[model samples]
Target: MAIIRPARPSDAEELSTVEHAAYANYVDHAGVRPEPMTEDFSPLIGDERVWVAEHEGAVMGLLVLTTRPDHLLLDSIAVSPDAQGMGIGRRLLEFVEEHARAHGLGEVRLYTDEAMTSNIDYYLRRGFVETRRAVDQGRRRVFFTKHLG
Candidate 1:
């Protein structure tokens, strides 16, 4: 079974490891490092904006969320490469939605690299609708939003 919990400052190194392992594939395809790969999660952890999915005391996946005025931003979701097929990503996403609902947020929003068609399809299948596409930080991104009401 997997346990989802808030991240701590001590988890910084492990979360960074997981983030890198999970997003390494995108570096080659995007011709640059994915945004998540370049982030310093230590501060986020301290702010309680991060969560981890652990199984048997091992970190399997993680989600980073930012609370906004009207909605929560699903900043990043990453499952360790070794744990990819175990439903960790789906569970983490569900957790994010529940967290949003609990916080009285009306919606959740996320963006993915335009090149990651599989990820875009996954979000759409989960009821997220495409809101727009734009170039941000030199990368073409596809944005999606899911209304919680």
Candidate 2:
């Protein structure tokens, strides 16, 4: 099992590698690379908004979350292609909800490129409902939110 925890600055490079692999398959589908693939993780790590799943000292997945006044925003989530089928992405999504509850937030919201159909289905199956769809940053995005008790 992988352990989830705050990401350290030293994990930046490894995090980028994981991000790249995780989104590589979506390049052709999205017609552009996923944003996280070229993002710099050190800043997020320093601000403590990033978390990592570690298995045997290797970063298997990462999550970036932002707390809003009424809900938590799941900025991004990715699991290394090498670590697929290990449930890391699911665990990270679960952590987003747990974090929201712990912070007394009522919901968790996230958006994905509309081209990522698999992600839309994944979130829908996990109880997230589509809130809307529109163009953002020149890409069509589908937004979803899950309300908590």
Alpha carbon deviation, residue 38, candidate 1 (Å): 1.0
lDDT of each: 0.92, 0.92
Tens-place lDDT digits, model 2, residues 1-149: 88899999999999998899899999987889987787889899989999999988899999999998999999999999888899888888888888999999989999999999999999999999999999999889999999997
* Stretches of candidate 1 exceeding 4 Å from the true structure: none
Clashes of 2: 0
- Which lDDT tens digits does candidate 1 get at residues 1-149? 68999988888899999999998998888788889998798889888899999988888999999999899999999999999888888899899999999999989999999988889999999999999999988889999999986
Superposition TM-score, candidate 2 onto the true structure: 0.97
Q: Work out candidate 1's RMSD over C-alphas.
A: 0.9
